[model samples]
Target chain A: MTEQGTTSTALRESITAGLRQAVKRRFGAAADIDAVEFTSLGGSNRTVLFDLVDGTARRRLVFRQETIIPANSPFLDPARQFRVLSLLYPEGLPLPEPIFEFDDEDSLARAYVVAFVEGETVPRRLLDAPRYERARQRFCAQAGEFLGRLHALDPAPAAFLAEVPDSIDPLATTMARIDRWGGVHPALELAARWLERHRPTSTRRCLLHGDFRTGNMLLDEEGMRAVLDWECAHLGAPAEDLGWLCLRSFRFGHVDRPVGGFGPREPFYAAYASASGHPVDPEEVRWWEIFGFIRWAHYNVMQAYGHQTGARRSAAFAACGRNIALIEYELLMTLAGHYH
Target chain B: MTQDAPSIDELLVTVREFVQEITPQLDGRDRYHAQCAVYLLDIVRRELGADGTDATAEQAMLARYLGDGAAGAAGLAALAAEIRSGRLDARSDELLADLTRQVVGKVRITRPDQLHPMHRESRPAE
Candidate 1:
């Protein structure tokens, strides 16, 4: 029983009316309350896909809630993450324009739900179906530009400033945070030890996707529409964000190259640096790549829990648990790759 | 070691089978028991398989990264093993795990053949 995505702790429908009421009150007549239906999907949070009309228009909105999973963020307050999304949406990040957020005692059993955005987020299918290669430059350039914009965001924003931790060594902090996840298994313990010794110095703190990578974003031929999954979003070293995108794991199988199935490391860095006006460091890139493994490993543990306890048991979590090894192996290679 | 040397997959199958068989028999709510079974199976399975590859890899990584630090830091000097041996009994699992982590870019890129993405995040938009 490999743990799959974040598993539901209180999956039972304890209070459906309360959630609908919360939505109706916050979004109000703007969302056309009479014509909406909610259906829950996914295991990480209670994901409800709601079909509703707004001003003689129909829209399908998605909402998410955090459930019980091993290795969940003890440090992160879900309300805090929701608040961050609320703040950043107005600033023009390509993220789903978050609408109607509430994290209290009776919101879908735990911290849950915001307005859903639409887009297909597939990387495996990307290699075969309607390839982005046709629109690679636009996709690449747009992603680079978008990331640059995010990087350039005034850390001065009260929304961002209030919640995000100001850590001196964010790289170590990231590893330490993830290392906490490794305790679930002895092998992950190995992963923890591996990350600690290899942690890198911080370049400049910027916003992190927390889970930024290939599978976490939405893109079309034109380019990235928006980044998704801010569960791990925080202000951190700028190199961390770029490095996360470049992490080979994000490439899925495209290890020969990096950057979410893009061309190569140099191009991805060049595109980002050009757009953001920040110098790229191979060393820092290397560091975040390790952090990516730590993050992935924790997520993997969460996935295992989702499969074992929660309902979404499938080949997905079982196979994903094995992925932890890939990251561990990659770490091995990264260490041995340039050992003196 | 035949009984003990079950492949990771085999162990997982056994755990799943065991949980599936016993969960229905539990006196309490079937779903609750079933959920408990799933998590328990996962824990057992992780303990079974995580060691062979992860532990050995950690050992090899630490040996490689130590890079002549302590004159006698070389691993299994008797075996003359280079970095990459991931055996818990073989070395410092704690330190080696961290060292390999640093070297491999942390994404833990392994042979694609070894990994299979169980659930890919298919972004909702093209």
Candidate 2:
């Protein structure tokens, strides 16, 4: 076998053995694992799905391990992500049930397991499939309701989220990341000036699913099943999540339907207002939507830099280097009121 | 010296076609990477096919803002610095127009499909 193949084999074996120990510790010695499969859905983590059989009961669970975290990554650490799940899962939110977190004894570093939620998370499939037409109709309200419920949750427990740079000052945080990534983006600099000058008034800071958007959500034909990918969760303006959900990038070619390419924004805004008792401000969301483009561009730059600097090597990331121009064009258009 | 018959653009098109044909046979990460390869190849093809007019126009536009001494990447960096330092805030309207043109030039190569209708209509006839 090649050197990389050999390394992967060793890693797989280690994960299997570690999982067996973890399962036995949680579900007794009779518990056994079967059908371990790695999933490529996660961008910065290793996701492995396995079925645990204890007597007649078989439960499919996901084991996610943090693989490559850049030094300036905005994602929450594995431990903090698990903590967020633990705190919010009991709130009756549509989230994966946290099974157990790995400790030193489990021999799995920075990994956690949660019960697998069944649904489709692919944006294109959800947006284009005829079977999802009804689901798309209901998606906006459901997303708004979820965000309202999520933002209503007490921020005291997730107080640790405040330490996130974005939670402090998102514009400064974005600018810092841009500077760190070599910062020659004149368009982004223009965006920074606009965002700085037109800062939104202080609103109630709440727990935000920082990466809330189309692909981050799992939905069936009925509606949303679970909100996934809480790595970007942080305490911030409630509208940040709403704006992120409406980002053109997340619309997946269905840009006409601003709400995750599902439907109009009014249903979402109305649902959010009804659920949270806070009136939806279109202007505030617009401000955030504009900021969203810049943030999205920053993320693309991050990926491209990672590829060029050999921190990670992937053709997809290499494409992001050029994709930045597309994003900048969109940003300029949005700023000029020529495009949403 | 003259180049071969199968030039860079031709080679890119051929490779992109091959990758697109083989994409269905691959699955998961390989399939995703193949799709990205197709996109990158298309970008290279468009870039290679472009004339030098846009580049020259962009440099002249930047020079208008940053003076003749500033040009190319250095000019862009200087413009960004000026924006960040708030020196260009008064000239934001003109800067925005120049930046829009600069970014549109790039999008013309990377992804013309993403351009606004107005911008698309504004593109010079082939």
Chain A TM-score values, per prediction:
0.76, 0.97
Q: Model 1, A116-220: lDDT tens per residue? A: 655557777654456666655555566666777778776655334335443344444544554443322333344445555666665466665556677677766
Count of backbone collisions in candidate 2: 0
Kindly report the docking quality category of candidate 1. incorrect
Please report the candidate that would top DockQ against the real structure.
2
Residue B53 in model 1: shift from native, Å? 13
Error of 1 at A193 (Å): 7.2
lDDT of each: 0.55, 0.88
Q: Any runs in candidate 1 off by more than 4 Å, and if so which? A: A1-16, A27-42, A54-57, A69-75, A103-115, A135-137, A158-203, A301-322, A338-340, B1-112, B115-126
Task: Residues B1-126, candidate 1: write the lDDT tens digits.
Answer: 455667776867787887777866754234454655565466455555433444454455444545433222234332222222344434654344454333232222222233224212211121
Q: In angstroms, how far off is A57's CA in candidate 2? A: 1.8
Please provide TM-scores, in order, for all candidate models, with all chains considered together. 0.64, 0.96
Question: Clash number for model 1?
Answer: 49
Q: lDDT tens digits, residues A91-145, model 2?
A: 9999999999999888888999999999999999999999999999899999999
Every model: Cα RMSD to truth: 10.1, 2.1
